[model samples]
Target: MTRPKISQMEAYMIETLRASGVTNEAIIQAAKEKDVSTWKQINDQYDFEQLLVLAEQDFSTFEEIINDGYAVKFVTVGGLERLLKLKFQKVEGKDFQKLKTGVQGLDLSGSSLDELKQMLSINWKITKNNEYVSVLLKEKKDFA
Candidate 1:
């Protein structure tokens, strides 16, 4: 079985951050926020929803979060993925790559309710908007 291990580069960065010389705020924040374990499990291994879990929780209806600010209820499977993909699909450059419907072995057909949520995140590129906005599905493969 393949296991996740912290890369030498990430360790080097962490050590560099620990050193007294580096004093940049963003770099310091990056050092504090970076996780080696997350980096490992994320490479074509863990589900895409793992990234979404780290994102800010949003409520369609204010009532859901008003109760405890923890409970999330996805109304429909397609609704959620459509929301995510529509919100995150990348559209830029002179020529933008069109996304195929296959990712992490997730097709629109067999993916479960929870699995669909893994695709949601704040890391999306706004491409265009005539009637609706287009978003690129930033995948696990994009991570360093």
Candidate 2:
């Protein structure tokens, strides 16, 4: 059987994954699992954009990626900043200052979600196990 030809975008994605330290075999496996027949198909079938973002990250370990339910990793200072913005809206003010003070001069690039939660004053929990890490918000009660 002849292998299907990959498009330029597919090639780019593969190269990006490879450059990010993904083994060629792993890339091929991922492509096969997605049944990626063309570049356009890849976008339709997978979170191609997210994958691109992950490629730019510098995750401390592959286990982190595997443990992250979204298969996403944030391993760069910029990536950490983006995550904070997404989760907290504004990365400024007292809460931000508290966070900064908590982790002052510390390297967060390779920190786990649980570790991050511990460093902040957020009322969220990191439900991390051998399988994955999930962030859950605490329920708020209405006071009379």
Candidate 3:
């Protein structure tokens, strides 16, 4: 019922990755490029180094941490209805059984509203439905 924040959207993406069965180390790596909501107030985080702090105390694995990371994507501004599009990548490990995770998401966290707008090209639009609204920000890869 509350408005969204950057932290909220981040929390949501983390959850999606986990639901996809991503690993802990991979999630931590993703967190370094992204962020998540913490226990302090509604918007405090432990920074990249502290991602595993919770795991240190509890019996957690790379898998377990990701499992706890699912949610609806929300941002700190423009309310919680606006959804941003992002890219995800999976870096495979040496063995076929294991995989390394990498993040390829885009956000304008430190930028101003104008900067955010300038970042948008003419390749995207916004569409809304009764249940949700989303931003389809995209760039044309090639005119060819």
Better by lDDT, candidate 3 or 1 = 3
**Full candidate order by TM-score, most accurate first:** 3, 2, 1
Writing each residue's lDDT as its tens digit, candidate 3 over 14-121 gives: 434444565556666545544344322332442433444433444344334354322233233222222232212212221111212111222223233233333223
TM-score each candidate: 0.19, 0.24, 0.25
CA lDDT scores, all candidates in order: 0.31, 0.37, 0.35
Q: What is the lDDT of residue 118 in candidate 3?
A: 32
Please list the Cα RMSD from the true structure of every candidate, rounded to 1 decimal place. Answer: 17.7, 16.1, 15.9
RMSD of 2: 16.1
Candidate 2 residue pairs in clash (backbone atoms < 3 Å): none
Error of 2 at 36 (Å): 10
Cα deviation at 52, candidate 2, in Å, is 8.7
The C-alpha local distance difference test score for the whole of candidate 3 amounts to 0.35
> RMSD of model 3, in Å?
15.9
lDDT of 2: 0.37
Candidate 3: list runs displaced more than 4 Å. 1-46, 72-75, 78-144
Where model 2 places Cα greater than 4 Å from the true spot, the runs are 1-76, 87-90, 98-144
